[model samples]
Target chain A: MRSPHPLRARPIVIGVAEACLRCVVCCAVETHFCHVQFEEGFDERYTYVYHCLSAPDPASNPGIWLCTACHKCEEACPYETSPLRFIEAAKAEAYKRGLAPRLLTGIIAQITSTGYLFPITPSTMRRRAELGLKPLTTEAAEELRQIALKTGLAEPRGEP
Target chain B: MRRYAFFPGCFIRVRLPHLEALSRRILGELGVKLVDVENFTCCPEAVSLSVDKMSWRVMAARNLSLAEELGLDILTLCNGCLYTLRTVNQELKGDEELRGRVNDALSIIDREFRGLIEVRHFAEILIENLEKLKAHVERPLEGLRIACHTGCHILSPPEIMGFDDPYDPVILDELVEALGAEAVDYDLKTLCCGWTLSTYGSREASERLLASKLNSMRRGGATAIAVICPQCFHQFDVGQASAARRLGVEYRLPVFYYLELLALAMGFSLDEVGYRYHRVRNREVERALEVAG
Candidate 1:
């Protein structure tokens, strides 16, 4: 499943190829420390280089999986390569291929169905009423549903 | 007094209405009129964008269109919402092709994102009117010590966010001090809140990261943690106990949304601001109010 957007399907790769080859900030935990530690014996540095070289091919690259989108690499890059943006584009590609994490997919479904990341449950309405806040109007929900349908994102796979 | 449309994103509306209520009260008192922008959806958070960028962009564009229809700039309470709306606003404004695509989808609902308005975080607005904010302080929070957590969305990708120096954000600290409190400096002040990773199956790493930050705040003698984002508030407030349990340490740091602190300093009572609703007991905040009275 390729990206519906022409620009997204083939993002304009920014910066020189040699710049990424010379820069090692994207993989260095010391340069931009991630909260998620790598598993034992998994050489983060080697894995990072492997992924960085596989640019525009997220399926083959492991760096996209390692990046936390912390934007540290972008900040730390002396050559202004914006490595994080490349990683993000790769993630977008992965998402198009139905490779997004389950937790994220669940969130997308909820947003599509309810117009909120979290469900506006009965108790939520009760709390809002108690606090004198108005409920989410039906008109707004319909607008969101239309947006989702037009984007072909949250449609119930087979049912239109 | 500048009037702006208020976009209270999902978290504050659903999980923490008190933050919204107190923000309205505080902003009103400061002479900034907050008009409710009805029928607003999620800023369609970055996480959602990662899953489906086009859908996220269209949803965000729709929200921006609502603000443009009212001919008012959006004032957001959540950092994530500010990031999403502002980034999308810039993207749509700069890319004619992308804007055309998004507008085409929006046309189905009789809406078009003209890219006419700007999006701002509530803290940015407060900082802009610091003189007025300081003038309205009836009871300065003189001796209170607070650690300001600006969170990642409002500060990162500095070119897009354009809020403060991302590396050393003092905007939140300045706001805290305006209320007569000491903005305690701590290490990891600029680190991610780890909320995103926590949700994505890195629970241990998230807890460890949070515990480290809490430990730093404790070392700095901060009585409470001040946050501008509801998500960060949840991490420090609701997630603190679990983090402490995981790390085998005690972290009793009470989390206060920046507006709550401002509301209190500007003469609103504890009950008026809904401090009791906080998960971790804000004994220090309670004591500060009692002493001020």
Candidate 2:
């Protein structure tokens, strides 16, 4: 079942995939064996990542792979390529194929429900008052919800 | 004195309001005028990017557009927000194709990212006015030993971040020293605070990473850890107790937001910077102030 979400359906650019094939710094860092893996000739890691990226079945790919979104790989890449962009694209594709982490889906659900990642409980409101910050107005919250709905990132409240 | 639109990202505003309050008070004292930009949303954070890059870019662009409309550069207090907004600004400015797509999406909300504004981390603003900052220090933190945590986002992807050398960042250290404190050098100075990993279901690895970094700071003789990012500050301050429990060692390292340290050097009282709210006691900071006197 393909996701009906707009962002889920967005195409992964071919250029980004080609760049990842050329430089697999992101995959190396995610595995945390960059030093040893590179010393033994990174060709093996590169081929493995290429297959994961080009794989037809998301389930066939290694489930151990995870990008912490640290962007260290992008920083460390000698070629100045943004390996993170490619990693993001791959993750988005995986998400569409129902292979992304379940925790991520929970986060999205929270955002959709509250228009914020975390709930603004009474204690939160009291804390804001103590710090001299004005409360998040109802209108502002509505505007945020509108943006989320317009972007197809979230559906209207109380709708499936 | 340049004017800037202050972007106090969600975590700082919601979880660490004291940091936000101190930043405003200290920046005003340091001759930077902070204009509050309203109707701003999240930088959408990096997690969103991994799940949906286009949506993340659009939301970030919306925030950037708010600053542009105000005709002031943005001053971000959180490193995560700094990375998201700055990277979006760079991408939109450099890539006409992506910008068009993002702008089209933004049009629904009646916003357009013209790419006219610059996104700056608070550390960059301090470094830019280092001399003036030094001149305003009435109470020098002379004997204080600080471990500076630049956090990952402020200096990473050096090409796009352009704030400092990613491998060996010294801007935060320099700022710490200018206030008459010793910025202690330690291993793992550039590692992530493990906050992201902790949230993403790698709790054990994250706790271990924090334990190692805190142990290093303690061994390096740091009295307190100075951070510009709230997430890193949380790891050392509120997260320290749990970390100590997990590692079976005591870590009493007090964490201070850069603004709190500066507020002290500029002669603000402990209550003024909300030091009492910190999870770890501010005894070391109090002692440093007493010794400086």
Among these predictions, the greatest lDDT belongs to 1
Native contact share for candidate 2: 0.26
How well is each residue in A1-160 modelled by candidate 1, as lDDT tens digits?
8544322444443332345764455444452444443322225545343345455555334335545455666676667776656656766656656666665667877776666777777877777787777776435767888888898876443211
Candidate 2 residue pairs in clash (backbone atoms < 3 Å) = none
Please write out the lDDT profile of model 1 over residues B124-162, one tens digit for every residue: 888988998899888988778898888878876888998
Q: Where does model 2 sit among the CAPRI classes?
A: acceptable
User: How many steric overlaps are in each model, in order?
Assistant: 0, 0
Deviation (Å) of A46 in candidate 1: 7.0
lDDT of 2 by residue, B67-166 (tens): 8998989988988899899989999999999999988888887889999999998888788889999998988999888889887777766778888776
lDDT score at residue B223, model 1, on the 0-100 scale: 85
What lDDT score is found at residue B232 in candidate 1? 91
Candidate 2 lDDT for residue B27: 89
Q: What is the TM-score of chain A alone in each candidate?
A: 0.61, 0.50
List, residue by residue over A1-160, the lDDT tens digit for candidate 2.
9535322333454444445544555444432222112212235445334544455543324321344566665555555555456556666665655565656666665554454555567887888898888775433445445566676666322211
